[model samples]
Target: MRIQKRTAVAVAVALIGSLTLIGAGTVTATAEETSVALPSASFRDIVVDGVHDRVFVSDPTGGSIVVTDYAGTVVQQITAEEGAAGLALSADSSTLYVALSTAGAIAEIDTATLTETHRYPTGSDTSPQNLAMAGGKLWFGYTVGSSGGIGSLDVASADPAATLVPSGRYWYYAPALASSPADPDVLVAGEEGVSPATLAVYDTATGGLQKRAERLFTSSPSISFLNDFAVTADGQNIVVAANNPYDHQIVRLSDLSSNGSYSSWQFPNAVAVATDGTVATGAVGDFVKTYRPGSTWPSLHEYGVNDLQRDGLAWAPDENRLFAITGFSYGSAPTLHVLPDAGKLDTTLDVQAPATSRKGKDLTVTGRLSAAEPFPAGTTVEVTRTDAEHPAGTPVGTFPVSTATGEFTFTERPRGTGDITYTATYKGDGLHTAATSQTTVTITK
Candidate 1:
């Protein structure tokens, strides 16, 4: 694996690598350069192994999977032949799985040894692609015969439970499968390889159809395949990439919620989602790098990922340091870049005062932590008053949490107050404070 140095200039109307603000014209932020590593395969597949803070890049060209630490060191490399393509890892992060499109078999790699421990044939004439490993089993998209959808292989025990469960026998070609981060079910995105490509959701655990949708936005007759997208780590949400013909926009799953049409949500990516379900996606409308749940304003300042030729995209548990992978022609191999890019974490703290207050008297305010993205777990969140519309040190309360979650709600309602200030601070790991987000309520005294 090698890394290179390159610069990405933002679109005239788009910010290169920033998170978007709600109603502002895109803002641009500058990133400092840091070392990083690029996959040996020019066309590579990437998956995050959160259990170890390591991300594995599958290089079909080299028949290897390159393992890089958070600091961008190539710690290990596992090689395989037959040109491996799609990749998957178990929910517990114990195994590394691959789809050998040419080999017509799913190859299993033990992350411990980086060696091929097992391989199962899909069919004599099968083309298996994009994999998702979860719930004591492995799932894949198999474009075999007149069948489409996904196939399953369970390697939970020594008996070798490998079974192919085709979702629907549509004429659809290759598709991508990912287990829902928020649920036990799985979501499968596929296209018929022509106009009106289809994206379907299936229950691989039970072979039940949850949803199958068509009318996906695509302009080309021979449409572009969905490269990479993600489901949230919690498993309740799923986002997919569907390039609408000449129109490019990451589709949103919320859009599909209305009719359960599978027509709702949108987000684009080449490869996405870490084991924890932290996703980094490519942008469609204005900027280059974007993450969904809808882009906020601040991301514009950081520069969304642009210039794929220069950098590869990565997400961090901190939600602040984004590792950009790049390649340069070195004397022996391409240069490895684990470029450290910083992202703005606009975390705000909000708490309801006397949340369930009775009528009339003013309830005291306490601070709570709300985040755009997950930081680290076990981080502290403090509560405080903004200014002297009141007094200082008004008996503030605090809590500890992993900055890596949606939000944390703490109830330490203050009593007998006209006005009060509460602050949440994350001490240790350096001192950090949330923007004072507050709310007020009234109760009968």
Candidate 2:
């Protein structure tokens, strides 16, 4: 395996085989972007297992899934089939499902052990390109010999079966697929080609068509494709990455009506929605732009990452981090970029106790969690105690940060003597890193 870092210009030039400027348009770059090198030359998709604190990248050419931590550190590499194109994490985050396009199979990798435990045949002559998990099943899209469609497998069955969705086929490319997080039974499939593009919603349980929207890109005469799309966690909005013109379109799921359209970047290939309702779009180069729920303009804060064209983006709400897979096209090497929320956090801890108190006397511990502003109400802080008897220390209690003052306090009595120490920790939310503070008190005979 090889690892090397390349700039946006270098990646773009390498991908196009020359720096002749493939497109007539230009993207605005406001700040510098950061990037981490990967060991693979080709990439297809990215997924984050926030519960396990790991990011997975599918490298179809390398036939491996590269795993990294929230810090972008390479932790492990699991060998896969020749064409490991799409990836999806189990709802519980225990198993990672990968589509082996060339092998015509899907493999399940144990997230903890970083090993492949099982493989199931997709039973399709065409190669599968995208994978989604919903309704306790693994769904995939495939295209071969001018025919394409969607298929799914029951994840819970002892002997899973691959069943094609009724009337799910298209004339050309496999439609891009996304499932609603709020309602697993709801799915959105989009088709992009020379003909008029189309979008359809399906009910996974009954295999029924809920709604279909055609003529997605009415203005573009050139071939159009659905580069990427996502459904808001609340199941209220569907966002699509319309390529030819490089526009983002939001549609209200309730009525299949266009909510709004925002044209901010040139050729955005990936888009994702956070649990907090923030929308992120990954364009051809340098930066990932985020926007507030109701606003079409970019957010005040932006995540700058390498110009390597991004193909997939996933948000890990637990860590407040975004995982992006780069180098989708061209001969450029694939890279995984881990971007944490942009900002700094401040925290403090204090102790109130006699310098030399009785062994069983009560002691008070207090702390305040602060950043640019006070944290949200009901935020939690962990308290731990350490003494000579138990040098390793033990978690004693947990307290909530006050909404009004950002203060948290708790009382405890020392059971043993000899320089007891109290420590408080705030496990940073989506916008901050974990911080800790400690104070010591002595016990008398």
Best by lDDT: 2
Whole-model Cα lDDT per candidate?
0.50, 0.67
Error of 2 at 247 (Å): 2.9
Q: What is the lDDT of residue 426 in candidate 1?
A: 40
Q: Distance (Å) between predicted and true CA of 399, model 1?
A: 17
Q: Best by TM-score, which number? A: 2
Give Cα distance to truth, residue 90, candidate 1, Å. 1.0
lDDT of candidate 1? 0.50
Q: Which stretches of candidate 1 lie over 4 Å from their true place?
A: 1-39, 145-149, 169-171, 207-225, 233-237, 245-279, 283-301, 304-306, 309-445
What are the per-model C-alpha RMSD values against the true structure? 12.7, 12.7
Model 2 spans with C-alpha error above 4 angstroms: 1-34, 193-196, 207-215, 219-223, 298-300, 328-332, 342-445
CA lDDT of 352 in candidate 2? Answer: 37
> Please, what are the lDDT tens digits per residue for candidate 1 over residues 4-112?
2112321321331122221111212223444554547543456666667776776666766778876667888776645577777777767888888778888888776
